[model samples]
Target: MTDKPLGRSAVYTVLTTGYTTSTGPGVAATVSYVSDRDRHVIVDPGMVAHRDRILGPLAELGLGPDDITDVVLSHHHPDNTMNVGLFPEAWVHDHKAEYRNDQWTDRDAEGHQLTESLRLIRTPGHSPEDITLLAGTADGVVAFAGDLWWRPDGPAEDPVAPDRDDLRTSRLRVVAAADVIVPGHGGAFPAGEGVPL
Candidate 1:
């Protein structure tokens, strides 16, 4: 629902859908976009229900579905990969273990280097197929940590994350390397000293 600049890349988040638990209605998932002049990548494009939410933003940037060079899915979760059909022209990629259908053209074991400055790291914890995109920017390294840990009000353990050990390892790695982090759900935040969240 908002867009902002992160180092050399312009990043944005689009709310996809909502669900109701016993408590009340809550957000289901969010899709994030990161682009530069040459490449436009959609990370976890969310469910089909919010397809327009994805399209509208791209249109604003003077890009169509065909303009997206890469459609990167962090994992195989439906809330993340359900809209893969929308970007047929782009090279769809995910972890090798998570590729469900023939739609994915490339799969990486360690990680894939999308650009000289952007690299995807396999940080499996939230899901066996999870990956994180690290972009070397003018400011510092920016990490697109997908479902590794949900943003909480402060530095607290993610109660809902399935694998605590993997999550901790991934989080510590990101925190050490990244100056800015665009999480799978929440707004971008600064990491390292002074900023604790």
Candidate 2:
């Protein structure tokens, strides 16, 4: 798994699993970002190998269970939300229409924060929770697409107009205008396929 920080925001994402695995070609990550002063956020904290063997990376990051600022889950997949409870102080954020949002408040009791991160892209072919996150960062505007669009080896794999036809519409209404794309599992990509965003 790869671990690195994005820019200078203290927002760190460590690859917990990868498509490189012999079992499959899907990548998973444990996403953490600092929301405010001394407040850190975590997302999709999972195990790298045996599912039972979790809770090590958090310590490696010098973070304790109660140090997390929030837990922003992209969807309901266990690979992304399994170790959520390990951080007792985190306020969990996710789509309410699709996933249970109240669980975080009850679990943490410090209140929870919600975001449009799951922008209702409606990319159903991937999954009901296959959504994305649109937020402004120090770098610039971006869309954190969970699995809406992916990079193909060539343009053949590139998402064409209305590429999300598999789930519902013959095409996506509009992808959020942004500078970059922080996909859920894959590495970030130039937004608009490298247009002047």
Candidate 3:
């Protein structure tokens, strides 16, 4: 599958760069905000040191919780889904279904287009249900890869992945497709070269 350039590009903002401790219990999920036409999406609104870490940046963008139209989870880990309740009005998207209020619409995330320039693709590895959000922005395609990489350095390997082979294959696919990668628990980085294969 290829990502074709779109006439109207999406805009993305890194709301918070998250972190994880190697030996201790501290962890946070990198959160991102994406906008395309009428859609306002929050990607991985997970654990953070403080709620302001999320809300403040959103406010700076002239948006409030209520303005969010959708929320996407890469997978169902607590670290990647802790603060979803903050967006009470947005539809929640995951690998298997879309949830909004009482409705749970079952649909495959593979090639699921959220907007003209925003879509989801299954990249299961870090978790069996892992999916990546690919946004066609002015800067090129940006992949919000949930724990497909914990960071740009790759961590070289994922200790908790259910399937390492699938993870590697997905990594290659993403590196080939994306110009930039916003990892699950770290800041964004350019794809290729240093990326772990």
Candidate 4:
């Protein structure tokens, strides 16, 4: 993979399942990912519902499960990691602080260092397994905050997020570290020295 700039390459919001179908906005799962050469890395595989809609965007980018090199899970919650089992071939990455061993390979850091262009950060709040992937090409920091933050209002924003305390500490990490934040289900949030959000 040649050295390149890192930014959001994908996102998938699927309908919720179980009792969630009755109340609250539908759940969403985002794929904060990037590609290098032919290999790809994905973060948080939302829900199994509307599978085609979930994976279709990637297909448009000419990506498939076989092309993925790593699958990083931000948390073990059903909405964020339910689809992980589908990618047995990819190296599954997640924070052991929250998730348990299963079919995918695991890691403790927030962003696993795949190359000089990548690094994962353990920004727990949304879940014990909560993590934020940062991309900086020996230059700057780009944050991918999984459920650690999200859109305030959306019909499909099922944020059964962990207590705000986790979200709070996680936000602290974001403030201390991130440059540009790609929140799970919201518009982009720029991280900086401004007053806390």
Candidate 5:
């Protein structure tokens, strides 16, 4: 009920700025690293030009795959989930559950708090199982919205959305809650720029 962030020190870094081609075969999911309290979270460790595109930056940050505590997937698309095996030790979070080695704990992503400042919100429509990771930082809330948009300039409409209304509603919710948005396939942008109304 408060507009204030949870007052925890959360830091986020976009390890790889992703891209998608209009003409041919090239794409990479934008990946991010968030650290809050005891949690080292990776958002969308998906397809990249190379594994080093993901691991190299992580190495630069002094973290190995073993150091990660959680991996959050916005949805199940292969492009957004290919490199998940890189972090074998982290619990994987999706819209409906958390998975680790041999465990699958079912839980709703809505309002699922991973840390004081990091939480999950169900934002279906990019896919029915889509979820967004909200990280509360000193600047404001940062919404890691996978395919909810391919980029800052949204597709205007998601061609493959099962429910366009749901996609729009989800987008509005994210726009309302986040000061910055890191799209699934592009660099982060301020919430106000070319956001779908």
Candidate 6:
């Protein structure tokens, strides 16, 4: 519903229809955009249901579908990857462990540099293929955490993650590596400042 700036990139949280509560929607997804010197990169295109909402923000930023050079999936969840088809020309990257599709290539274990300042880290936790995109900007290290942590007010634990241990480990790694964290479902927050355990 709101787009916030995280370093050089912008974080857009899209509310999807699923379980709704008085507090908020039970499920929400995050889509982020990082502008490199040459082209723009989209992280987690979000669900098909929220395609228009996603594209509108991009348009406001003067970036069309064709301007996006890459689409990175943090994981293979429907909410995270459903809109991938919208960008046919962009290179899609995912963990080879989960997606074996020939069209999707594997992200390096060490990490892949999408731009001079943006890097992709394989931080599997919420899913076997979960990854966190780290970008060095004027602000600091901004981490786009895909389901690594759910809500900003909630605990670091992700209720949906099958492996709690893995989630915990990944959460710590993200916190240690990032100054600002763009969570999968909420607004971006400072790392290790007011985050719950």
Q: CA lDDT of each candidate?
A: 0.63, 0.43, 0.90, 0.58, 0.90, 0.66
For candidate 6, list the clashing residue pairs, or say none: none
Q: Is candidate 1 or candidate 5 better by TM-score?
A: 5
Query: Mind giving the per-residue lDDT tens digits that candidate 5 earns over 1-197?
Result: 64324755789999999998531278899999999999999999999999999999999999999999999999999889999999999999999899999999999999889988998998998899999999999888999999998887778777778999999999988888889999999989898857874
Q: Quick one: best TM-score, which candidate?
A: 3
lDDT over C-alpha atoms for residue 73 of model 4: 74
Candidate 2 segments whose C-alpha is farther than 4 A from its true place = 1-27, 30-34, 37-39, 50-62, 97-125, 149-163, 166-175, 194-197
For residue 145, model 6's alpha carbon misses the true position, in angstroms, by: 0.6
lDDT of 6 by residue, 127-160 (tens): 8878887877777777887777655764555566
> What is the overall TM-score of model 5 with all chains considered together?
0.95
Model 3 gets an lDDT of 0.90
Off by over 4 Å in 1: 1-25, 97-109, 152-155, 193-197
Error of 6 at 153 (Å): 2.2
Instruction: Write model 2 residue lDDT over 1-197, tens digit each, in one string.
Output: 10111222333443342222211344454343434345565555643454333345566767666777666665666655667777666656655432233552323211122332212233333445444444445665455444444321112233322333453331132233446555444455665553211
Error of 5 at 87 (Å): 0.2
Minimum summed lDDT over a 10-residue window in model 5 is located at: 1-10
- Give the clash count for each candidate: 1, 6, 0, 9, 0, 0
Alpha carbon RMSD to native, model 1: 5.7
lDDT of 5 at 132: 93
Q: Give a tens-digit lDDT track for model 1, residues 18-108.
A: 2212111343445666665576777877654456877886787788888878777877777667777777677776776333236534557
Q: Give RMSD (Å) of candidate 4 vs. truth.
A: 6.5
Stretches > 4 Å off in candidate 6: 1-26, 97-109
